[model samples]
Target chain A: MLNTEALAGVRYRENDVRVFEELVRRYDRKLYNVALRLTGNPDEAKDLAQEALLRAYRGFSRFQLGTSFEKWLFRIASNLYIDRLRKQRNVRFESLDEPVPTASGQVEKALPDWSNNPEDVAEQNELADEIQAALQSLPINYRLAVILYDLEGFSYEEISGILRCSIGTVRSRIHRGRRLLREKLAPYVKPAAAAGARW
Target chain B: MTCEKAMSLMSAYLDKELGFDEFRQVELHLAYCEACSQEYESLKATKELLGTLRAADLPREFWPELRERLGAVAAEERVAPARAKFASSARQSSSRQPRWRGILRPASGGGGGSLFSSPMAKALVPAFLVLVLAALPMVWSTRRRPAEAQVSSRIDSIEPYFRDYVISEYDRPLSDKTSVGFVVTGQAVTMYTSDLLGPSSKVTRASGLREASPLPPNTAGNEYTLISYPR
Candidate 1:
């Protein structure tokens, strides 16, 4: 269980070390899941999650008393993942202005489209690898936005706080991130499957 | 709304982030435009696909390793401040001021006061001072100065081994010439010197060793002396 009081009392030492350990353990599963989705590898995810937790513990002094611990932890995980990507990003060049290829073997300036119905996609019958590959294909920021919103079920406001951006920017990132992800997952999804999703 | 504009907002529309007027605009537009409607549907589908990526269980051994690493981190954070504080307080004790004063000492030289200064820096400075004082005992322990018993008479001017002791302990460079001078006035021992630069040599107050030995009664207030240790 997450010892909220112990975390709140981070400045105080009377709280047993076991309490802090329990606090980290409580959020381990969630952070691991979010990290796994972001990195697409279990080993990398584990490393990212551990680093995020360690950073959070060190920086606990700045954390306010009443704020959401989960969101704070998520911000650390997301930022670490983004920071790692940024270091490696300079090695290769990818211009978002350039056209992205579509499932139809065509090229366009904007994100591509998925032929499958939204209902069918949400049904959860596909292999995990298909979704993992699609997520990894997205640019780091876009991948984070989508993962935070859909995978972690964070509110736009919470994501804005985590990413340290305006709500409008969060909305735009989530929108664009989902669009690109849909384009990537289009091939894995089936068309003409009784499109239950309407605009 | 036009197809391009409506499609741009389709993502927000699916997210229900649109306000009343914008939502109405998107709703009215999506009611008629099949392309915009299809885009919104597919966009939602892509985001939903992420929900299916399940979290895998970590190996049992990983937890123990992580816990051990965390313990190490905790120990470091705990020891760092305490070490710096104790060293700083000890250093402050050697000075004429009461040891308690060091704890309440102003962190900044300016009138900004200690309250506004960094708590961490304030805590560590005194601890660092303590390490500086350790040179006196270290010299005796290492037997660097065989006649070290007489070194403690004038605690202020630790000439022979202060610089070497500090450099050895801190493992850092020091100024070429470290000249510290002291004058005993009644019960108050006043140590005064400013960026006094001279060639490295054993120097006393009057000429060389004049001020170092007992001062002559005739020497007036105008006469200032320094103890200079050769580097």
Candidate 2:
């Protein structure tokens, strides 16, 4: 169809170095922000994003135009951060997101009903700080999965490619990561005003 | 599904990565289970709250700094492959010539008025040439290291690695239908540089050699190992 974004993709693939700046301009800010949040260091985030772009440039010819460039870029950038995290060994690897039985045949989180009022979860600004802190506390695998799923709104399939793991793993990481975040931020949440406030 | 199952699937429900059966079970349970419903709400709230933590307020220096760095990287990328290519070509030219004669004649009693009549004359000529060939790569590497380093300052940047390159040239009379001359040497330094270092580092890098480049294991000072490829 020769759409504009495709043309840009094609231009990029053709070694049109000029087009590189435009792609960088278009994506660098957004990518840099995500990387900063992921790595929790602005300087590291900048380097991460820059490395991703450099890699993307080198491999652009292999990138097909019909697919999503944003996803491709994120896959590269997120994977770099993921690889770095894996190296530090601070991230404890967890299970697949699938429901599973223990050797004792008991599935964790099988019966679920636990709730308290959370609408007064503090002001947005206050909550934002707490959430960031909470995110920083979780292991890198969980953190990346949860943030990519919730904050960035990527699908399980997309995240699988980004993480280079099975979809089951993505699900598990998101759940576990979110569990850790809730545990960290639970103190900041206000008591329920009413029984039916649900949220 | 029990409350445990429903709870386990809560993230899947939120993410929509669940299968239909599992999705329906979680949803049906959420409607009836007050606790699970409320928990879901809180999780949802957390997701929403994080959305507010938008892009950091970048310093005015961020973009300028990034742009300048990218420009430098771009310039390096443009030049590195060309230099690597030139190096490869120079090495190839040296390799195409016969070297066995150099080795054999050094010890042979070909002492004559032709070139090697006196012992001093014979010894000095080979010794001097050996000095040049030995020093050639070291000098070449020293001159080239700074520039190569400039291109791939970052560890992960695509520095091109060249390895086990074989170059051949044959000169045959028009009357002869058969191949005449060939030179193949086993010991050669291989260099591995990622493609990003230069404009055509990847494209121009020689590939499909019979052997995987068993180059220097460490790429520190990509110059020293690569400079030897020409010899």
Candidate 3:
């Protein structure tokens, strides 16, 4: 199998759609998962992942050969995600504050129910939901840092490149993000640890 | 190391990203300080829990759908150059005659002979003419309006900076028929000028403006400046 750079080179030099398709096959699942974790919405995740790939194809000519294609691709994805967030910021703010019309009457909108009892978080699926909710609750930058570092397993340097921040900033964000996560998931952490030490 | 210091380095320590001395310090601290050790364990546990969350695979039909979309995109890209050629030919013809006339002339074998020779082009001329005629009045009225006439009230305050230039946030052609606009938000001024200046046009210090940095390249538009002026 050709390495990513070599594949990218073939696609770039030969304009081979087959090689590009191969690249898409390799990355679609991982990209889709990352988008899912970031947005916590499967539909949005699918759209974001597909859009990212389309953008990658459109901008393939600009990609420098010999550089990490993964990072370049991720940088595009992250930037698109950020742009979407910015565009949606006002709509999200307004929707959150606006009263939703119910059958009874228009009432004050309640925030998402993130607080779960320790007992309720016992199931793996429920635990995953809690973790995802906690992850989504974080500010965008910190959430991105944590997702890239811990979830996606990108190195700090690669993350800094993908996020377009300094390595020091990456380190700080990851540390702070983990601390925030630990606080939110405190109720389940101990029991899960006692269940079995997987790490 | 103080607990605060050791705890701050906990993530790096767990990730094996710390230097040898820093790693040693954190290890020694975690070994003795029960609180820090617990904190380290909790952080590690959180990461482990995150890892346990299985990645949801894309639906089975996702690749097929994406492949279809890619095929459509490829088809569009292939058509784009032919469209550009037709447009350029129309533009060249329009320089000598009316734009609508230039467009219709293609059917009469004026330019882009291959493109306009199609049966679809024969049907398009009359429909396009009707549309253009309907839109002509609005176009004429807009063209007659002064370039600076619709400048926003907000831009009036900064009018002194470039009295000669008509500055508007909205996309409007300059008096010279070039699209130019400058947005001043707080201290930063972003100038987006299409056709008037190339993408690489830089702001000289002599222009009483300090170039801060170029913003990230926008995919849809030309790159512009994020500059500030010395008040």
Candidate 4:
């Protein structure tokens, strides 16, 4: 099988559509998942992923060979997502002072205590949803750092390149992002710790 | 290390991104400080919890739609350069001199004589003069407005000019803010916004023929208003 670099070289030199298609197929799942996590909407994720691929094809000539294709592709996707966010001005606002209408009575909105529940399949799904919500609550910069580092398993350096920032910025964002996540997921963390899970 | 410093390095310590001395300092602090240790543990648990969130599979329809779009883009790319070549050649054949030069020296034999004698130029000259005459008031009115208003309106009208350009954006995070720079390929213009999310002042230059100076810093905000137009 041809490596990504060879495939890219062929596509660039020969203008072979088949080579580009193969390249897209290889990264399609990863790109789509990243988009899904970023947008938190399936439809938007699909569109964003598709748009990123189209952009990659159009700008293929600018892509330098022998570099990590994944990073290059992700840079394009991240830019598109940020651009869309800027255009829409879609800042999510949740007031901490607002009272929640619970079944028993009105109470302050707070993170629920899930420390006692067993890690069953259903509970896991709910936990995933809660994690996703917590991620969405963060600022886009911090969210990108956390998702790329913790979820996507990209190294700090890789993230710095993909995000077009220095390693110090990456460190600051990940540290602040995790701190915020810890605060939000404190209830879940205690239980996982009690269950003897190592970080 | 102070607790504040230890807490700040907790994430890096857990991720092992810290250097030897820094890592040792953090480790030594965590060994003695119960509060910092617990904080570190909590951060570690948070990262672990994130690991449990499974990656969802790409939907079946994604590839099909993407393939269709790629096909359309390919077709358009094939046709675009030929069309541009024809247009350029037609323009060259019509008049090699600049418009202003032709207007100033109509009797000059160097591409100006044939241009003024052409039937198309004969009709276009009257229409051009009429447009300039009609636009005089509007131009005067626009110039009379505040310079800031003119800049805002120019930024708003930038979308139409970008139709033929391919835009690639680079976002650089400043110490406390984000600045976005847009590189437009296929055209000689480049635009820079000092702030990404606020009412930013952008600098746009079109091939060095015309350049708009950046607006005053006080009037600029961090949010940029994107101008959208239908293709």
Clashing pairs in 3: none
Between candidates 1 and 3, the DockQ winner? 1
TM-score of 4: 0.58
Q: What stretches of model 4 exceed 4 Å from their correct place? A: A1-15, A90-124, A191-199, B90-231
lDDT of 1 at B203: 38
Question: Which number leads on lDDT?
Answer: 4
* lDDT tens digits by residue: candidate 3, B37-123: 777788888888788888798877677777777777767777787799999999887687855564444455465564456788779
Interface alpha-carbon RMSD, every candidate: 2.4, 3.2, 3.2, 2.5
Q: Which stretches of candidate 1 lie over 4 Å from their true place?
A: A1-5, A10-15, A89-126, A191-199, B97-231
- Residues A75-146, candidate 1: write the lDDT tens digits: 888888888988976797677677777788757576665747866775553567778877888877778887
True-vs-predicted CA distance for residue A174, candidate 1, Å: 1.5
Q: Write the per-residue lDDT of candidate 1 for residues B162-198, one digit (tens) a residue.
A: 4344223222255433344455443344443322433
Q: Could you give candidate 3's per-residue lDDT for residues A1-199 as a string of tens digits?
A: 3265655565433355556778668778889988999999998998898888888887777987767778888889899999999999778355677888999999998786675764555554687889999999998899999998888888999999999899879888998998899899988776333323323
Interface C-alpha root-mean-square deviation of candidate 2:
3.2
Q: Scoring each candidate complex against the real one, what DockQ results? A: 0.25, 0.17, 0.24, 0.32
**Each model's lDDT:** 0.69, 0.64, 0.73, 0.74
The residue ranges of model 2 lying beyond 4 angstroms of the native Cα positions read A1-17, A58-68, A83-125, A190-199, B57-59, B98-231
Which candidate has the top score in DockQ? 4
